[model samples]
Target: MASSSTPSVRDHASGRLKRAASTLAEDTQSLVSEIKKAFTMVKNIAVDLEREKESTKVKELETLAVQLSESCDNCIRHASAIHTVGNEYQPTSELTDFKKLLDEQFMKLKAMPSQNDRLIRQFQEAVWNVHHKGQPMPGEEEEDIVMTSTQSNLLNVKCPLSGKMITDLAEPVRSMDCKHIYEKEAVIAYLPRNGNKKQCCIAGCPKFLQAHRLVCDPFLLTEIDELRSMNQQTEQAQNVEDFTGLDDED
Candidate 1:
């Protein structure tokens, strides 16, 4: 005797499962930070008694935290697979083959490196639609809005104010208003010239540069790291080529 509210309860449970998975993922990533804090406390205790800091213990704790974090990540993946199936799909003998195939595909997805970006985006859009109903979900870009040239390429971009390259070391940040990037220190120094909010340094740019609009460009930092790796590889190749050329001359 199933009640009329059974479907509603199932839907609610699905939402809760998704939320719990998200929270668990966040907590797992933060575990390293918590370990660092605990080690700091341990060091403080050692200082009080004038004893040597337990560096070896700290390393063991960090290793344990990393292993636990990996386990939690696997748990999140399993939970996500269950949430994706929903409550409507009942396992029957007729659907056994289909269920097996579905599970295999999920396992493959778990092993895929790009699964994080693709699956997370899909799940976020699905969750937004489920909760928001009639409202349109925000996307990467809008149809009506035109992106500026600065927004097109984030790599090796220059700070408009200082005429210097913006990299991770420069503390790069992006403007939420114009999607333009800047060296964080340069932008901060430029803003006070015209009383808090200054016009963007790029010529003909209409957006005002304010402290609140500038957010840390994490993607830019990642790109910078990749670029540095590429440059190092190129330099090594050139050195090898030069050495080979000298040997040929001999």
Candidate 2:
């Protein structure tokens, strides 16, 4: 009976060992799954950080591009104005600095897009305004007898041949050549007529008598000649109207 009890105790001990081994296997599997989940989380965080870094870089580049473009535009405009003035009045020390600034800005702008048109147009207008504004009035220069501020100011004034005043003087006197002068206000009124070419209204002025002085104002004379030719052609056509009533004898 004692031998029989020993065998039963051994069997129970073996069964308990088996159950512990199964529990160990399950814990090992759980540990492996947890490690995999942690690795996945770390990978996702790394990816997000990379994307954020790239997005920040793009924004910075965009800002830099805009600043570069504006700087270039301003440089071009300033340089053009300075160059125009320099051409007419000789270059100064300030102009040299201006040109250097313009070159630096233009080099930077060349890296940007869509700046060419704006640059060209700005330069063109600046140069044109500087060169053409208040140019010599196209007409005959006459020595005028005039009184000004308690003194007689003899002026070599050029009067507009298309019946217009060139200067805005107070109480202007008319020339015998049909060049009528009034206050400067009169000149403003005459600007629209004949595209601002002041016409000489003097009766004996060659402008009205002979078409020579009339044609002196290039743009105005062109329009006047066109209108005259059109009138002549229309009158000739009207005179050629057919009179078939006398053909009844045929």
Candidate 3:
């Protein structure tokens, strides 16, 4: 009789674990979906780099991003189809622990794109190398020349929000989330009027957001100043252009 009861006890524990795993797998979808989008951004950057002229490093990152994306997609199918679970419902402490592990993986996935952005923003030598591939990295004097060239190109560039070419960023504001800089007054006025739902105006911005708030971005202002000083001074600015694709705002 004791031996017969031992089998029942073992089966009970085994069934509970299976149910928990199933629930955790279902919850993992939301996490994995966001991970998919981030990898897509990496792929877009890779394409842009290719158009500009590819760097070996950018290609390597692109390949890695694809591998990670496919792996995440496979997990959804594999985890949900576990054949070990019983037909009945079971919620146990085991399921709770399994869900926590999924949550940790979710955080890790979120950080991956941020890591890529940091590489682009801070270490643009990788991007410079892409354009200058075939030639040695620019020396100090060469870098100065490159800087002058870059600044000159931007002088004619107009603010995306206001078509008027910006000579100086008297009050520069960058999207806190997206990092797309716009003239302070233009964005500040646009935000509250749109129910405080501001978005990055740049084309194909990865981090466009329903901006809840705005803050001064001095770094952008400084860069604008350098560009402004390169040419004749002008205090006049053009009127804010009609915001395209924002019909819902009215």
> TM-scores across all candidates?
0.35, 0.20, 0.30
Compared with the true structure, the alpha-carbon lDDT of candidate 1 equals 0.51
Candidate 1 segments exceeding 4 Å error: 1-156, 168-170, 193-196, 203-207
* Model 2 lowest lDDT segment of ten: 144-153
Worst 10 residues of 1 by lDDT: 143-152
- Give the candidate number with the greatest lDDT: 1
Alpha carbon lDDT of residue 64, candidate 2?
43
- List, in order, the clash count of every candidate structure: 0, 12, 0
The superposed Cα distance between candidate 2 and the true structure at residue 68, in angstroms, equals 49
What tens digits encode model 2's per-residue C-alpha lDDT throughout 104-169?
Answer: 544543453433333232222223334343232234122211111112111213344333333323
Angstrom error at residue 41, model 2: 0.7
Model 1 reaches what TM-score against the true structure?
0.35
What lDDT score belongs to each candidate, Candidate 1 first? Answer: 0.51, 0.36, 0.49
Best by TM-score: 1
